[model samples]
Target chain A: MLDLAILGLLFEQEMHGYEIRRRLRDELGLFANISFGSLYPALSRLERSGAVAVTESGGTSSAPLLSTGSLGGERAGLRARRSGATLGTKRSRKVYRITGQGRALFEQLLEGEEPAGADDARSFGLRLAFARHLAPSARLALLERRRAQLTRRLATDLVRASGDRLDVYTRSLVEHSTESTEHDIAWLDRLIDAERQKQAASRTDGARSADSTDPSDPHSGDAMTSSSPTGAS
Target chain B: MLDLAILGLLFEQEMHGYEIRRRLRDELGLFANISFGSLYPALSRLERSGAVAVTESGGTSSAPLLSTGSLGGERAGLRARRSGATLGTKRSRKVYRITGQGRALFEQLLEGEEPAGADDARSFGLRLAFARHLAPSARLALLERRRAQLTRRLATDLVRASGDRLDVYTRSLVEHSTESTEHDIAWLDRLIDAERQKQAASRTDGARSADSTDPSDPHSGDAMTSSSPTGAS
Candidate 1:
């Protein structure tokens, strides 16, 4: 989960660890609280896999800078070396940029199916937060999958509420849970409908334009937006 | 959480491990899937700590049974040996009853303050499921604590939503989450109001009767029923 979020953020801009954490907390607000304990290792793993490149970043910049090391042993002197020999503090800062390989990995992780259980809610929410990166079809699949999961939960909740002689509190909890799941399914339905409508509109535009090619394919297209449903806040 | 659920179930009736798991899933629906791996360890820990007593219940019987040992021993004359010499499976199955110490432990665990975190929802749900066992004041306190927790969450979520330039999908997720929190707070308010009314009603009843005392104090009084608020389905 942290890996997906980290990559998504880095995909936006090269960032040091502190800046990444700050953006995660203050900007995206996807993760309410993230510990450094889990963040550094994810970055290091991404680096080790050649999916990300690390630069010294001049101790101040959080952007990617080419390493001023001996590229050909002689090119080191061809251009004045950047002042990024040993940038960033030992631990709290080291600019990380997503490599071409990292973008591929990020897309794969974003589209992957999450395993079912307690982490399902967080996983789906995280995926939705990055839904703009997904193909419209994949985005629709995400919403549908969550709607199905919630619908199944509602069935079990209803069965428990009906069959069991629950006390007032437990019964109320189950009933409320069922209502919430229903609300989620309704919201997903609206999103699905909007996705279809957007697809149709783009397809018509693609057909009408003679000179312009439709970039509606997964890799080229912009994200589709959905209006809030009648079942919303 | 497992410990509290186990003790709460046993507080109602002495039960075998299998029966306990079934009830947890089917009856209370507390743990959607309570694995035996966790349940057995909890039962063993409770027994070791003198919080529970295990008896050799024949695999088929789910009722309380006397402990029997050494069928051929001379002490059979003092008391006839029960047929529990070779009862239950080797380890996975045993009848566990809450001991006097166990009951005390259960009460303490049920009434204890749960710290706010990832497990807060499950912990609060488990506590509310067993609210019948709590004193009225504690029940009210539980609802209020949850209400305060939700209120805090709502504030942070609102701030995040307001400050962040969220994508449509993520913005929707946050808005829906905020709405759910508000709904939960409304439910808690209803519960709190009902708890106060129950206490007030019992106080009136106590005042009405001069000769016969009203047994409407915390433990003796029945669980209060809260009507679902206008904020609910």
Candidate 2:
């Protein structure tokens, strides 16, 4: 989950560690209390795997000078190169940029089957947050997968509620859980309907435009826009 | 969280490990895929801490025979004691029952201040599942605490949504998250109102019945019932 969040942020822009943490907290509202302990290691892992490249920025400069060395090598070089510089100067910072490998990894992770566990909700949320990068069918599949999971949960909750052993409080908890699951399914239904309509409308437009353009390219302009049903408000 | 769930179940009736695991997965719907790898260790921890007592029951006998040995000692004793018996005899299963310390621990965990993190949702759900054990005041506090948390989350989400850097899909994710948070807060508000009404009704009844009962005894019948608003289906 942390890997997905980190990669998603880097997919947008090159950023230093501090900036990445800030955006994850403020803009994405994820990993709100993520520690530097975990963040730096994830960055290092991605760097080691060649999914991201790290470069060193000068103490006073905003633009990072691209460095070809590894992160450790760059850090040592920076220290040696600046040994005789003025004291009390700011230290260099490492900036990270996603590579082609990272982009492919992000897409793969986003479209992967969700592991059924406690983190299912977070996994789904992260995938939805990056859903625009997905093809139309893939996006719909994501929503449908979530709908199926919640439906299964509702069925279990109903069966539990029908049992005779539950106390008043436990029964209430199950009932409320059932209601919340129902609400989620309804929300997903709306999303799926909107997706189908968008696809249908795009297909109609594609057929009309085919007469003027190449007939071979069917999905000429199928990219999602900001006018998505949920995005409108 | 696992500890609280185990104790809550055992607080009602003595259960073997399999039954406890079953109830947690099917009834609570909280830890759907908890492995015995984690479950047995938790049970052992509870037993070690004197929160629960474990006894061995013969495979053929449904009723567990009371033994005072610790889990390990009992395991060793069982091996030695059953060695002379039939070779095909079923192995004894351990049944766990909450001790006084376990009950105290459960109450403490349920009423403790929630730790803020990704597990906050599961933590709150576990507390609510055992909420009848809490005093009426504590129950209200739980609901109010959840309300406050969701309200804060909604505020952050709205601020993020208003920013322009978000793309179509990221914006939609934020909007959907905001809607869910709003829905959760609204549900909490209804619960809080119902709780207040129940407290008020109980208070009025206490006053009316004060003549026959102890005059100083208030909160006479403030226990929550399954008639809670969300439980009405």
Q: What does candidate 2's lDDT look like per residue over A185-207, in tens digits?
A: 89789888878877787688874
In terms of TM-score, how similar is model 1 to the real structure? 0.73
Please give, for residues B1-233, the per-residue lDDT of candidate 2 as tens digits: 78999998898889999999998888877777778998999998899899999777664654445444345576766576578643444666788999988876876677678877767878888888777676677788999998899888777777766987775555766777787778778778887887887778767888454221122223222433322433221
Whole-model alpha-carbon lDDT for candidate 1? 0.71
Q: What lDDT score is found at residue B127 in candidate 2?
A: 86
Task: List pairs with backbone clashes in candidate 2.
Answer: none
Clashing pairs in 1: none
Best model number under lDDT: 2
Best by TM-score: 2
Q: Which stretches of candidate 1 lie over 4 Å from their true place?
A: A27-30, A44-50, A53-91, A207-233, B56-92, B207-233
Scoring model 2 with DockQ, what do you get?
0.36
Instruction: List residue ranges in candidate 2 displaced over 4 A.
Output: A35-37, A58-89, A207-233, B59-86, B207-233
Residue A81 displacement (Å), model 1: 26
